[model samples]
Target: MADIKHFDPDAALETTLRLFWRQGPEATGIQDVVSATGLSRSSLYATFGGKHDLYLAALQRYVEQRSEPTFQRLAEDERGLLAIADFFSELVTARCTGPFARWGCMVANAHAATQNLTAQNADTQVRAILDRHHQQLCQALTQALTTARSLGQLAPGTTPRSTAEVLALLAYGINLRSRNGADAHALNQTMQTALNALTPSRR
Candidate 1:
């Protein structure tokens, strides 16, 4: 017979993801996971392997649960630049307020943390996830920009692919800054400046 587990692994993983998102992987120890999940070290190890393994699981969960849906919406939306504007607006609101306030993006935080790690210590799995995230975000933005150009909303000489790259980096910047307590107003202003540069003149 298979061994029965007493705790909800999904629930525990959600809690673990939030813990890692808020405290980061380096600062969060197994004890912290134990305290946060109310699980024994033995159970955690049995279910999730070790700290590194758990952190990787949490990162995957974060991307699946939080990031992918948002990217999917942006990629499918037909409103062009307006969709992109709404995307940034919602991003700022989520980052600066609510239960998730100040937690930053899990992926962005991981990217920042990786910079401090020696090449030998860097996790290729983590890099892969981050790379996939960047590609997805850019693809969504590129789709939106393509729609915008079709509708004559794009400024003359602006290219969808190049603009998508800029906006992808900008999104990362907002994530990092918001984690550092940058206000919603500042983020919105910066987003607007970028959007305005992409907008066509009415005259």
Candidate 2:
């Protein structure tokens, strides 16, 4: 007879997600997932395939649960540049000192990691996540720039397309720096300089 599954799959998946998020795939192993999720090897393989499969599932979970909502909020926000500022401020604060401090974003971490990642198609998935991130940032920035231009806040002839690309890359920099121990104040100063450049100069 087949063994009946007693544990909660969603809860187990979340536990695994936290483990992978904190330690990353190169540093994490099947033993870590087993310890974090309290699942037997047979059960884990039966339900989630293997370590590589579980990592992929965890990454997808991070994108859906953590990443999508924030991006949606930024894209829909009507606060223009202030919205972008809030995003950077909140991003660095969370990265430097929050409940989830120093974890760096999973997608960003994956992009930056140089160690052995044995998962199949991980590079392709990372590219997909980054491409999605870029598109979402561009959408949010374009909206904000249109509003700022309408209100005469943008300098003459500033292009939203290019500016959004710069800010998107800037955000990636913030993520990487924060992961490497950058302080929140310093990160905010960097954000301010970027925002100030985006604004029209005083006469």
Q: Best lDDT goes to which candidate?
A: 1
Reference-based lDDT, each prediction: 0.93, 0.81
TM-score of 1: 0.96
Give the alpha carbon lDDT tens digit for every residue of 6-88 in model 1.
Answer: 99999999999999999998889999999999999999999999888898899999999999999999989999999999999
- Residue pairs that clash (backbone atoms under 3 angstroms), model 2: none
Off by over 4 Å in 1: 118-122
- Per-residue C-alpha lDDT of model 2 across residues 67-137, encoded as one tens digit per residue: 77887787777777888888888888789887789888887787776335454576666567667766876
lDDT value, residue 14 of candidate 2: 91
TM-score of each: 0.96, 0.90
| Error at 47, model 1, angstroms | 0.9
